[model samples]
Target chain A: MTARTGVAGFLGRVTAMIVKEYIQLTRDRVTFATMIMIPLLQLVLFGYAINTTPRHLPTAVFSHENSDVSRAILAALRNTAFFSFVREAQSVEEAEHLVRAGEVLFFVEIPAGFERSLRRGDRPQILVAADATDPVGTGNALAALSGVVASALVRERFVGAIAEEAQGREATSQDAFEIVQHRRYNPAGTSQLNIVPGLLGTILTMTMLIFTALSVTREIERGTMESLLAMPIHPVEIMLGKIVPYVMVGILQAVLILGAGIILFAVPVEGSVAVLSAATLLFITANLSIGYTFSTLAQNQLQAVQMSFMFFLPSILLSGFMFPFSGMPQWAQWIGEGLPLTHYLRMVRGILLKGSGLSDLVRDGAALFGLMLLAMGIAVARFRQTLD
Target chain B: MSERAAAPAGTGERSAADVAIAVEGLSKRFGANLVVDDLTMTVRRGQIYGFLGPNGSGKTTTIRMLCGLLTPDAGRGTCLGMDILTQGREIRAHVGYMTQRFSLYQDLSVKENLEFVARLYGVPKPEAAAQAALERLGLKGRGRQLAGELSGGWKQRLALGACILPGPDLLLLDEPTAGVDPQARREFWAQIHALAAEGLTVLVSTHYMDEAERCHEIAYIAYGRLLAQGTVANVIAASGLHTYTVDVKGEGPREASQRITDLSQKLSAALGVDMVAPFGTSLHISGRDAAALEAAIAPFRGEPHLVWRKDEPTLEDVFIDLMRGKDARR
Candidate 1:
């Protein structure tokens, strides 16, 4: 053939492949919708849902003194948009229970003589308790407490008293009702400390799910699975072999992201490196196995991608990476719990932020380990082992 | 290993033989549709068995059954002297199935594809084996070239290389030369014959007649049923088709060609004519009923420009006749 014919022939074959791919993509309605609709959904949904300066955080009050001054103080706290008192705790113990159960973000305590002291010019303290497990959630709320308190005293009687007793108190910290605020587990509310650890789960979940899902389905779509099935290799062997490479990829991605997190974000790793590594490995395997299960279920690479994105949608949106897990409604929390990311997020945050060890994270570790088994079991069971 | 020694574990009740594959009453049904129905066939060791069929005729389904890639819903078979039902993995170990499409990793280099397959089959000294395969398949200097970058013919060669890299006893090729050029197809057959000479049994499916003729034995199937089997001459002779070559030379060459084209259409639908196929410049009119076909074409025989002569039926003619007869019965 002439060079002209060769060039034309090359173009002809190239165009045919391109055209075939376009036609396949357009013909598959689910895949087409997933390609177009998912990113848009993620953008709009995550844009509104992820709030770092989370307002209307559930706060409860326990005041031994029920007077106008204390009421004004609580009302001012509400007005600051930092706290919304949804419950009235009868005692400080009840408020602590609310915080531990994740029912409230902040708990307030007013001594019985608080209102009387404000009137009589005797300074009495009021205590504020904040749930700081997810330190990012309550950081801003805690910072707004003093402002909420100082403005509350600006009401009619306290203002006149402060002006009258200028010599006694130019409002030296002694005269004001001292708002003792407790910044929870992560007192400094380090953003990197929060995000870097979460990256271990988020990055693994994203890459692991998409990689293994696409890899297996791609073999089927490329016609290689038929040859693979005809070979002597067992289905279990294929599954594990397909998994190990992506697991390595996942590990590499984790290391890179974690490195970036530590350097750029200054995220701290407080817990044992070995614990974090083991949990992360388990989490990566879980995501990959789930992806492999999806690969077995899906007919083509596009369908596999769609399945991964479907899993990713809930994971990114509700897995407590982008939003506080406890802040979401009970149903969303339940859904998040069912996802492996939820448990991994808790473990990473616990281990890296709270300095939690293996014993401290046994529940989340077990949940993650259990999820890996279930996903892997389903993947092996669903493997057809034949073209049929 | 001898036949008995080569026999796979768990099947001591049956005697071993030269047959690489043997099946009885094989049937497979996909949901409500039966794909392969009560198919009984045997392929002798160390021979090229040509499998021919129209599309959707269960050619692939049958090949799958032979290699242990599929299990027939109702059948008993042994591949390489191992029970296919109980020893699918054992059967798969000794069989190489080349799919209709190029199935090796396109991203991998030629050498890598060979090495991967070699490793998967646990071939001894994989690097040496892959190198030998590369050299044997004329892929010596192009070992580093990506398999995807090769032309259709080269891709086919590479796929064929992967199939034989493991030293499989039986190679099941599904339309291995479907889109390859004539020269490439010829070379592919040469390699296949060479392998068969070394006692590697092959069951290959194809659409081309010349390739079918190259096979030592052939089987024709259509719509999940086997219609004919045996050597090339045996299949054609058993077809019972009487073919007549019609040559027309009218006033001008163009006019004669046009006349032949027009006659082809009419003769295709003529009463008692099974098929009227254009064979190059001539037309082959064939039917199962010799007397009826001769009487049907007798009127045209008297035309001075036309010469009618009896001809041996081609494999194409036999397959065409088999397909038509099968369709008519349905």
Candidate 2:
């Protein structure tokens, strides 16, 4: 009878606590709005703003000769949806100027002897120059230009047997003229296949950190923390209790984002699903720990939110989420390496696109683990023992 | 230890084993200012101990140190037979401390607040404990109502209910009835006395003289010093104040008050008077010496505008005398 009573008593206490927490949660309108509104807002914003399969790239062409051959190539470029012909540049210098100024993403220049070479049974070379500042933009432009050139070669084969016969004397149809191209990642080149994996890091960082930062600070402002502190529960238990619910929320968001990436953008999960999920969970846990640490240092809910934004600003800018890590300066790369988000971004991208195994991601995993432990330890130690 | 363990109800007569809380040479200082200085007192088990002092007199600080919420800078004490410093958490587990301000969750229901407190203290069967606490505090049907929606009186009741839900052996109430209506304060005191009757030790700080009178023993602290400690009758007797009431008729009370003030100053030389303050249409004149008090009011006896009579000094008169003595020392 005593044992039964003890169990009943413990259960009663837990139930009462959960009910009280529910009452406070329902009353806190800001947390309620953040939990329901933020996810929906992120979904809509990310759905439209993020496009992995970049297409219909704007390109300009400069032709020194306005002959029928150059005109046919320009028409082929215009007919292809991949290359939207921006305008015709009068000279090679003008097209180069446009590429330098970033007005046109890529430019095609046909040399002066283009029509004479085709009639004389000699292959003509087409020079493709692109502004390689943004690797993604450069890669998409190169792919579109390659497609247009391949179709133009096939059209030349049917125009006249003399064009093919004169080209056969110097080389076979396969080696008539080569389209020399340069892309940033996968320079041997594939476009949408390279960037889809990197989007996971950006999505996780934005959602998980914002949620955890506000939850604890809101409890402090509403004066519910006093009741929580007065309980027999330890500080570590309280910290875990607050973080566990948010971890579940973060996982749900990850699943939805990954599902959408696969269905809409054709992003393939080339690596082990279990490994990817584990890495994602680790990254989310680390981000949430940072949020909890921010909560402990902040005096109010507004300050907590401001500190979260301070963390998020650096994560987006210096984590190499949108920009290439290798392209940045050495000092900038060092700064990026210091951020846990940068390591996570690399890990996710490496796993999804490169099919990297555990040995390849040992550094990123260890960095994230170290950061998570440090942040959670500080949060637990610094959380105020008294309500005051 | 046996004396300390005896419940307050059983110890009707004073005995060696009557102390509930005992401390000697208790002192606490904040920087240069002494917040609690050289205080010594003993409270019997089950006594309703009232702490009376003006603002900034360290009443709250003293209560906090007594309940183990704060450590005294210079003091050795025992609460419920345990050392105050070493056994603080153990003492805290058995003590219920209510701050002057409303510290309960405002957004939660009264029932929810009590349940949370019960869970905090690890009370057995918290819902049952909470229900019993609510019913005891006369808040039976208002369980579903939000604490924020309650009136000041109801909030006070809920706060009291939360504090007592754990069935603590000692209760420390710091101005628990402040801002409460008069009737609510009366009802609250009745509940406090009932708890004391059940062998619960209560230490309450209040500014009200009537509340001080309700306590089994009252301690008057002024400027961080324990000026007096005793029952109402004993404190008044120890104050050495001989008071006289002068009832003025057929004139405005303000004019009568002014006339009495004028007469009081004239007789001050012969009487060695402490204070002469007007209370409504009557003037209450007090002094330390009995012979001098009789002689000082002799002129007022012959006045046709007033009727004079000797009366016992009230708790307020003793408190005012204590305040004046403190100021005079300063």
Candidate 3:
């Protein structure tokens, strides 16, 4: 006993601990496969299925005058990437029905006086109405319409100026044109690029946390924990033994997700891979620790899984994973920023596409580190006390 | 520390230096109810010590504390010469405990479970140890069988093998033969006695009187209190119950029984007759006072329909008397 108190002895014990854990892990085939395969599944599903930058938006037009000017506006709208002219309406009533039924997201109506006003050098009014139910769809429609309107106004003023110069009239009147632009992040915004990277965070968090939460509680239900506890092993050793295998799974998930993002959506890893990997590992650890904490509190495997879903629900909704962060109310924005997922998502996107460095990711990194320490500390403390 | 000669009780078979376990003032309480009260007892090495008690009499709790699986709330004791409090791990290491219910891995094979336990206890050469245990327990052919698929008797055998594979100095069995068939119970006791003969101290708790009679010494506890402690012969002698069997012939056994009950009450007032129980076509009446018991059944002696003869009080009579005495206290 005296001779075995040094480094050699400690290493021997650790090796025995690791070998025993691996043997037990291999015996449970379902859990082993889940650990290795779930990440790859998540990567492919989220990378290809989710796209935030909207394209080919369905639009309808209503023209009362049936003139060349009205026809020209419809043609210009179709020229942009934002709108795909789906139908034409003879009256406003027909266009309104299309919008309400969700047949078209945007509709343009030209009044009866439109051609007459343009010919008399007076401003002709045109109405652009878009469905506001889906905020993303409405935003894209408005962006494309604004570009079309500005060009039309510029051409009209140019024509009037040219006519005045040819008539040699006193240049008392002025031609006015203004183009107001509203740009959301990556404003020529490709939905695939924005959503694919964010999906990586959401998918990884849900799968990894849920799987870890069920692991311990399942053993407890099966009565295997009694045998485990009877062994002359420390609780901390068991915790580490359980987590090490899952950490490898987390890394594998990250690689699969990154690869899918590149191959399917051209999501570039513009930042340092090391920085991204480090941040990702921290966030995954935080999530796993949270799951372990739930496991300690739950009485059975089903309850533990349910509790994991409960945590995941608020995280996905309030973390700005699906919606634009700035568009939300101030309180919601504050809440979104406070969530651990929010910081991790921002960090992931910044690193993968924005080429963010360690210095650039300080805030997100600090938040994730704090969350990891807090969650792991609470989980270990709860688990140790739970056994007693 | 003074050397004393062995007491001449059961021939020179018992020795004074054979005290394997000694404990004093053992008490444990759960919340408001006391599960085991202050108690003192001793067990000799190479002996099967029977612990008999009714259900909820703290037999299991006492056994657990003795084996170092549980800590007594207030007590001082030594098990296998290790301090119960400070050297619990060491005590547990040297004591094999089998619970009433079968607690084993159902998914694992019998051999795998034994090997796992051996490794957990840090046994040297676990494979060899498990193999030897299996062969010794007559489970050599069924070592690879799933534990869940085994019958009750087979499961019991496997449990016994797992417990003894660690080579503990003492074995604590809590109702080890419960739910086992008559033949299996006999076989289990044979194994227990064999282990006891090899200087392995055995403390077993059971409700069967036959099992209690096989032990070198028996202790009966009721409601957290020790009711009796001694060999079967000594306990029966101390009970002081005298008995008489009355045989009734013809189709009037029931009528004769009623007539005897009336006679028993009359004699109880004058001579203190204790209990009169009907056994099929016969009646057995017993009392602690021998003179009173003989005088009480005198009236039924001269009839052909009822024949009364003096008989020895069985162990069952002694136990029934003890249970009645304990019940009267509550």
Candidate 4:
């Protein structure tokens, strides 16, 4: 029954608006896709993929000892499942090179006299070197090595002496084997040490993309771009003029964030400030160019914002911000390698945590710069000087 | 021979110095519809030329082509003594285009908007030029206010001020005063005429008959085709419309005005009375031929309640006739 007045009419009007909104929402495929797909995609990708205690870390064993005890230790380390021995290093120098090149996460060196030390009960040291540039990547692996050592001597060959010493209140043979861990890069395994550097790239990426993506679209939305195109300005000049100011905004945000990170988190800038500044400039410009490209492609402000977030989603998840870069699958990592943020995060972490100089960041930094040039080229090409 | 070389605006013939904007065989098509079709037109120096057309009749597209803001799909022209196709950038430097909408940044202050435009045009002493534009346009003491906060009339004047700040030789104003009050429109036209008197060629597009009448020369276009172009008297004469003014009397002032409206409605459906519009205390009836119009109104001629005499057709009659004629063609 309908009393087609007052409250009923109001309800009818509200329902009318609701029906209109649903119709409009369904018409825009991009918005509809974003509404349905983004949440489900992020949930499935991040839910099963993010593992805090990352295992199967590529490890290398360096050994001069061929004793039964050394073999037992290597077998114990392999049985832990956290470390996978991919190669046998010829020497310590070779092992260090493997870690430096990011080929392996942990290097284990079983020193000489491992069998003699076990027989004499003289605690022989086992050195486990780690690549601590990503503290999250190596912390759990380093802490779990003690369990490897305890189970390393569980065989009947050394149990009688270990049992006799245990009865006499002397040190067991397991105690006689010592494991020394050297956390390289970020030795203390601090989260801030890892996060503060990544924050620089992430913050710049979010702000630069949004600020520039809205600028050109804003001019068009307000009907100012037609007059702008009618003037004697080139497309390159228009892109640059719209972009350079936002570049300054990105820099200002960078300076504030970096200063706060230094003061509040005590995350040390181990490398030269000048080198960090250069990489930051290149990274900020790259993101701004990408945002400008989106502005040229988007017809309206809503589409511009949607485009920005679609790019932002991949950047936040796959750029090694929330998860360890090496922990992700090969396909995910391949996609990460293509994003500017991935390269920028590496370059920033290299400079701040790893004490990387300009020469040290040449590979990732150059990739970031090349991305900026490509984005700038696309933006200039897509930016039409006339409405036609 | 190519339409380029054969048309009057062709470089092979007249020089670009005399014409502020000249385009020959201009045509533009969007998908299947011809928004502008093989239209040729020219405007001389220091003249205020009016473009009158219905909406979607390609007035803005033609204006943009002349100013080099748009490239015609098929055409050749020159603006400011430079080829509109190849030398668009050079032409843009010399032409000031005021858009149909209020396009200047509304968030910016009035003076700031003027200054930004001045800078874009590379005007020397930009600050002084902006200040002078503000004072000249009667925007003094309001430089700090946001442009969006200004009334429609003030916004119109500020837009004009911004256009003239660059000192361009040719100005293309697309409906400068569409919604402005009559007083403000009068002032705006007066200022535009003053600017034209100083050797600045002006091309304005409008729908108002009074505004069209203010132009030195008026061009009427309908449905992407040029219908008529001439002085107001010439256009009216060229329409071949014989008109009659029928005044009503023997009634009170209000009653007489109402009677005039009734009479206009009565004669509106007559065979030869093509247009019947109320004017003050009388009705103006117009048709294509004198004999047909007289024969149509002869039944009302002997009525004691009405008096009639021959009159000239109005500018509005000619334009509406031209519009209706185009509509009837298809």
Q: For candidate 3, give the lDDT of residue A100.
A: 95
**lDDT by residue for model 1 over A173-231, one digit each (tens)?**
53232222213554443444565566567667776787678766887888878988887
DockQ of all predictions against the true structure, Cα-based: 0.22, 0.27, 0.12, 0.17
The sequence of per-residue lDDT tens digits that candidate 1 reaches over residues B214-266 is 88888888889888888787777788999999877545778777888888888
Ranking by DockQ: 2, 1, 4, 3
Using lDDT as the measure, name the better of candidate 2 and candidate 4: 4
The lDDT per prediction is 0.77, 0.74, 0.72, 0.77
Off by over 4 Å in 4: A1-182, B1-15, B253-258
Ranking by TM-score: 2, 4, 1, 3
Instruction: For candidate 4, give the docking quality class from DockQ.
Output: incorrect
How far residue A77's Cα lies from its native spot in candidate 1, in Å, is 11
Please report, as a residue range, the 10-residue window in candidate 4 chain A with the lowest summed lDDT. A173-182
Q: Model 4: how far is A360 from its true place, Å?
A: 0.6
Off by over 4 Å in 1: A1-139, A142-182, A327-333, B1-15, B249-251, B262-272
DockQ agreement of candidate 2 with the native complex? 0.27
lDDT for residue B62 in candidate 3, whole number 0-100: 84
TM-score of 3: 0.71
Q: Write the per-residue lDDT of candidate 2 for residues B139-232, one digit (tens) a residue.
A: 9999989898999999888887887787787888889989999999989988998899899989999999888888888899998899988777
Candidate 2 lDDT over A225-258, as tens digits, reads 6435433445665666567666666787778767
Cα lDDT for residue B126, model 1?
61
